[model samples]
Target chain A: MKLSDMQKDKCVRVKSLGVDAHFLNRITSIGITEGTTIRVVRNDRKMPVLVYVRQTLLALNREDCEKIEIEEVA
Target chain B: MNSIALLGQPNSGKSTVFNALTGARQHVGNWPGKTVEKKEGSFTYKGAKYTITDLPGSYGLTGNSDEEKITVDYIKAGHADLVCILVDASQLERSMYMLAEFAGMNVPSVLVLNMMDVAEDKGISVNAGELSRRLGIPVLPFTAADGKGYDRLRDLFETELSSPHLLTSAPNLAEAKSLKEQGEAKYTWITQMLEGVTTTGSLDYKMSRFDRLATAPVLGKFISIGVILLGFIVAMAICMPFMMLGSMFPVLMNEPIANALTAIHIHPWLVSIFSLLIPNTLYFSTAMAAFVLGVNLVFGYLEEKGFIARTAYQFDGVLSKVGLQGKAVAPILMGFGCTIGGTSGTRVMDNWGQKMLAMAIVWAVPCGSIWAVMPVISGMFFPWWGTLLVCVGILAYVFVLMWFVSLVFGKKLSPVETRTGMIMELPPYHKVHWGHIVKEAFYKAGDIFVRAFRTVIVISVIFWVLQYSASGSLEDSLLYKIGTFIEPVTKIFGLGWQSFMTFLSSAFAKEAVLGVLNAIFVGQSSLLDATFHAKTSGVEGMALAQIMSQTIAPAEALALIFACTFNIPCVMALSTTYRESHSLKWTARVAAFYVGSALLLACIVYHIASLFM
Candidate 1:
């Protein structure tokens, strides 16, 4: 599922960053990589969404959030 | 004496450690040719003195930003005898990444695990001895905020020192790893160290309870607005006393002071300068000083307490829509206080183009000087509700103006970079020490006062000279001739010539707008005109707005107020804009654009208000 589509507070493991390489590098440098755990702290339509990854909070726009591929953690 | 620099990410307690060590002996300055601050201080330990530099914090030492570039350059130049790397103990997995980056530099280093108490509270334990063996450096758990473990920290610099070796090439790492896998490889190595040397006492993460309500994606936006509005009101309220004292200057000056000066043998020109120029100057200087200081104190406290990061996080999407980063919210909000301070605040932005574009948009927001005079002007003619309309109207206009300008200049300025997402670690909320806040407010107010005084005084003296001209009494002064001459051109924007003159002078200082209106209206109107009440009446400061409303139609008054608020800000802001951008072409172009747009908006406001009239 796309990261932005995840329900609030649901933990997910990142699959692969489906965004452009430039964005992928940035996300990686910030400690987000494949298999990392992320939780959607908040996601609202018409507003920026908050994601908690690796003990840091990141605010991503809908477009950028859509580019991150993830799977619900069992 | 040897020198060592303290380096860490923001909120990693670098400043705490610096204060713990140097305490009151620090000298602060700016990096050469950059806005980033350079802080250095020295202390003596065991008969040996050492100099300490606090490097600006950054996510990593990349060429992505000025702070990063300065960090790398400072290290490569071999300025530090040893680099004391500070990391948050509770967030080691992520904070240690900087240590991983530092390993490539081959500089001698020591790791100070700051916030050790917090780490213990989180039920985490880091085996410093074993981890030190793996990374080929000494690691010590520390709580810098309390000056705990100072002995161990100093010993690493003093006696336990070893020749630092490259940490990138770990002994147990597989040889197959390539250069590209350096980050992953380091993490893998760190994970191995964690396996043996660390014990996770609990899996239950401790999160701030306040974060839930504050970061609620939808509600958070509204909360952020409320917080900002509350911030504005509190700041204004703090300055209320000074503003009242300043308001009394007009009465105090023209009556007792002016009469006494004339009663003495003081020259009339000197008397005119003192009576006309000095009172307004004192009034504005006091009012402006209070406003800037209050805004910085309030906002700076919030930022220190970590509320600002959540605000940036919550508004990331909204900010991105306007072609700015989430962090840009800080400067834009601060622009309401003082444009110069706001422009300087953008130093944190790594992208030069985005910084420049943000500066452009900030000017469109009416600044604190305008905010000071706004209620004063509107109170007489505008019902309180009408005044609220203008306040809201300014906010609405600024946002729309941002949208329009973003479309026009977005691509050219902030062309998409690789930073699709930001990493914002919101530090735990805490009370700010007011001593530092007051110190900062003092510096900010001092800077604003000097800059405002320089620009306003020069322009005011010129205005005074023109008003008391050799031509004749006030009717034949140079300003009267100029005001009447511009009637045809000023009429296009629905501003009477006198109003036009005040608006023009406002570009030098918005705080002077009320004073100019009082002088010109009192000078020009017939003595019998009861409404032109400033010079001839018992009531002094509040009479300008009433007289203006009575003399001009509401639409024209609205037009004049609209134009004055939206016009190019003060001379201080102009020079500051120029200084920040350092591009004469961009500065002139932006100023020209503001003047043009302000007039267009004024004309539109005038015609719309006229329909109702």
Candidate 2:
């Protein structure tokens, strides 16, 4: 599922970031990578969904969030 | 004296530590490549002086931007003897990446585990000695805010230590040509080095009730609105004492200067040149400048505490819907405090189109100076209801203007650059230190005062001169002729000759409008006599607003208020918009847009109000 589709407070593993190279690199530089664990801390509609990645909160607009694919962990 | 280059990721409490170290000795300027600030300072320690240079914060050394280039270049250039690296102790996993990259570069460094109090509160115990031993560096755990463990950190600064390479156990880098490979190497090394040396426990981030509301999507919108309203209301409240100052303003600034000038027995014309007019205009501008400065200090304090980031977060969706990014909110919020600040504030956005569009839209917001004078003018014209009407009208128009201009400019200035989404590490709320507020207020106010003083001094004098022609009556003045020339055009917007003249003269500085009026409109040629004449005359009130209302119709008065508020910002904002955008084309386009729109808006308001009349 796209990261934007995930419910708030759910932990997921980042699979791949289908974004522009420059943008993908920026998020990656901040310790987010494929296979890193992240939780959707805020997923309210009409607001940028905030995700908790490695003890930091990042706010991603829906346009950016839709490009990142994620999977639920057992 | 030893030189230390302070380096860290953004918001690793580097600034707090820098402030604690240097106090007020910092010199701030922009870096060569980007508009990002370069701050350096010096302080005395035990009879020796140490200079500190704060390098731009970057996530790692291998990014593509100028920030990455600048940081790497600074480190490799060996400008400082030792690099003082700061990292948040609680989030060692993420913050350690910088240290790993620095070690990879083979730079001499000492690590500081800052915010030890926060880590201790979270129950994350850092074995500083063991970690320091493994890293082959002195790691001093510290909290820069209240100077916890700072003495030990300062002592370590005094002692010479072996240059530490914390990635001692990492394997040699593979001969990978990919940029990704170099970044991954540093990332992997950080994890490997910290494996046994650091342990973590699960601790939830403490979110306040206000934070929960502010972060919630629906509630967040309300919270943001609440914040904006609270900001406005507080500014209004703070303006109360200053408004009292405004009442006594003519008495203090105008009366004395006018009185001393009257005592001079020089020729009348020469006395007019050297009269209280020039000095009184300067004084009036100083008061207006102070009002803007005070409002911005409140803005700066909130921005320091992270309210602006929350504003960006809360408005991200709405801004995106309008073809802008969430980061656009900061500049817009700053537009309330001051438009020039708003225009200059857009430098942080990476996209040129976004910056231009943001600046163009920010012109719609009525700035602090407008707030200062509009209240006074509106209260004068319509009494209590007039101020309310103009304020409510401006607010409604700002929204309409932003939407309208976006449609006109948004397509061409749409976001073409894919920018990094902001990571909202909301700063922990702290009690505001009044000391810091006052210092910043003066620094900011002093800067603006100097600029306005320059502009207003020249313009107000020209305006003062224009109050007289060779014929010397108020009607024969160059101001009257030019005001007559524009009166017809401005009359379409319900503005008369005096209002038109004030608008033209005020383009140099808003406060100069009242200054010019004091010299010209009452035909008394002096502020004190003008007040005295209006009071003794059948006019019920002695205030300038009362005299102004007797001459201008109600419909015209409302239009004048709207026109002045919505017009192009003062000369200061014009030059600032140019400097910040660094494009004469965009700056000219923005100024032309505001001038055209403000006039058109007033025309519309005038026609509609005329129908009601």
Candidate 3:
């Protein structure tokens, strides 16, 4: 599922980033690479998705968020 | 002196460390041609002199942004004897990505895990010895804010400078074709090196209570407005007392200085320059400096405490629709305080095209000086409700023109693909570091004051010359002759000679609009004399309003208001826009566009209002 579709407080791991090399470098440099655990801190509609990853809080607009593939962390 | 370069991502406390080391011995300048600031400072350690260059912060050495390219180029150019890479100890998992990206650089380096205090507060700890052992380089835990571990930092620097240690545990990725693959390799390398060497103790990965309100979906927008309003109000409060004191300068010293210069048998024009011209300009600069200082202080505090970033994130959705990113709102907010501040504030944007676009839009915002002139001028021409309507009309048109200009200039200035989606870190809230805030606020305020004073003073002298009259008759003055010569053209926009002169002089400084009107309509000898008389009599606003109302029609007043409000903000703002945008063609284009648009708006408003009058 797209990371933007994740509910608040849900933990997930990045499966793949469908973005190009430029954006892929940007996302992964911030520690959002594949297999990194992320918890949705705030995912309200019309707002940027706020996620907690590796002790840092990142806010990504929905368009960027929708390009990230994620898997439920069980 | 031996040289060192400090590198880190934004918010890694690199500046705090630089300031702590250099103290007052820092020199700030641009990096040759780029607007990117180059800060260099020096300190003596163990009887040895060392100079430090604080490289611009970047996410990595990926050469994506100018900042990143500058950092990588500087390192590759071998200007530094040692490279000090700083990472936030509190967020090493993310912050160390810089170090990961730096793996292949073959430069002698030391890793400073700064912000150790914050990490300790969260009950996280790292074994520096083990990490150092694993990475094959020196690592030190540091708290740059509290001045902790500086002695050790110095030792580490000294040791690294003497016998540089390149990374042995990490593979050099210079041969890597794609940055994505290099980033993946680096992260994998970072993960292996950090294994068993760090502990994140029960880290609570959640937004704080205040942050919840700050980022809440629809509600966050309202909260951001309240917060921004509150911040602006506080800035105004802090500035009012200083501005009031500044206003007293012209009243207190005008007569005495005029008498002294005249008594000294000085030329009347020379006397005017000293008595009337100097104090008036001083008063203006004082008000500008105090208010800009307040803006820097309050907004600096907001930015430091991390609230400003939240506002950017909250507003991204709305602002993006207007062909700007969330970060563009910062410059817009500063535009309400001062256009120079707003123009300079565009430095925060990473994209140069976006920076230029933001500067162009800042010109459309009714600046502080316009706000000061508009309400009183509007009140003179219309009733209370009508005055309020004009004020609201100006604001409504401000947004309309903003969208209109963005539509016209958006594609050429900022390409669609460059609207790179927002991917930013929302730093944790912390106490305001007063030392850093005050130092920065004063530096920015002082820089702007000097530039603004230069522009204001030069223009005031020219205005004095134009307003000079040996016969003391308005028509005999050069300003009147020239103004009337152009009156035929200006009247097309509903402005008489006096109003045309007012509109022209306003390009130098908006407050000068009133002085022009007073000089011509209120029977003052010159612009300088009018400013002095108005200051001493303390009835400038009320008196000028009454005089102008009788002489100028309500329709013309409405036209003048619209024209002046949208004119190029000031010469200072023009120069600042040029300096910030680094594009002479764009600056001239924007200036000419504003002038044309201002006249067009006036012509339109005047004709429409004339039908009713």
Candidate 3 stretches greater than 4 Å from native: B17-51, B147-159, B171-181, B200-204, B337-359, B383-385, B404-415, B531-555, B571-593, B607-613
Per-model RMSD to reference:
5.8, 5.9, 3.5
Clashing pairs for model 1 are none
Q: Score the docking of each candidate (DockQ).
A: 0.40, 0.48, 0.67
Candidate 1, B1-613: lDDT as tens digits? 4788999877787876776677657776657766465779987888888789999887666336667888999998999888999988877776776776677687778888887777777666888887887777778888766645677777777753445534534423355253325546655655665666765212234456677778776677677767866776777788789778976876677567768999998987787667756676666666666766766677767766677777777766667777787767777876887776566556435445677778888887788778887666767677899989988888788888888767766766666553355555666665455665566566656655665566556766775665655644556777678878878887888888777776776676676576667666654432111111122233255666656767888888788788888888876677656545656666787778777877778788888999996
- Listed per model, the TM-scores of chain A against the true chain A are 0.88, 0.90, 0.94
Locate the minimum summed-lDDT window of 10 residues in model 2 chain B: B531-540
> Which candidate ranks first by lDDT, i.e. highest?
3
Interface RMSD of 3: 2.1
Which 10 residues in a row give candidate 1 chain B its minimum summed lDDT?
Answer: B526-535
> Which residue pairs collide, candidate 2?
none
TM-score of chain B of 3: 0.87
Per-residue alpha-carbon lDDT of candidate 3 for residues B1-613, written as tens digits (9 for 90 to 100) = 4899999988887877888888768876657766466789999999999999999877877756667888888999999889899998888878989998787787888999987777777767889999998888899888776644688888888888888898777745666566656766777777677777776322258567888888887777788777776776787798789889988888888899999989989988788788877887777777777767777787777776778788889888777776777867877887887786677667556456677888989889988778887787787778889988898999999998898778878877666665677888998886565776677667766766676677678877887788777888887889888988989999999998878787886677676677667766777446656543433233376777888888788899999999999999987788677656656777898999889889999999999999998
lDDT for B124 in candidate 3 is 76
Index of the highest-TM-score prediction:
3
Q: Report how far off residue B158 is in candidate 2 (Å).
A: 5.5
Could you give the DockQ of candidate 1? 0.40
TM-score of 2: 0.76
Order of quality (DockQ): 3, 2, 1
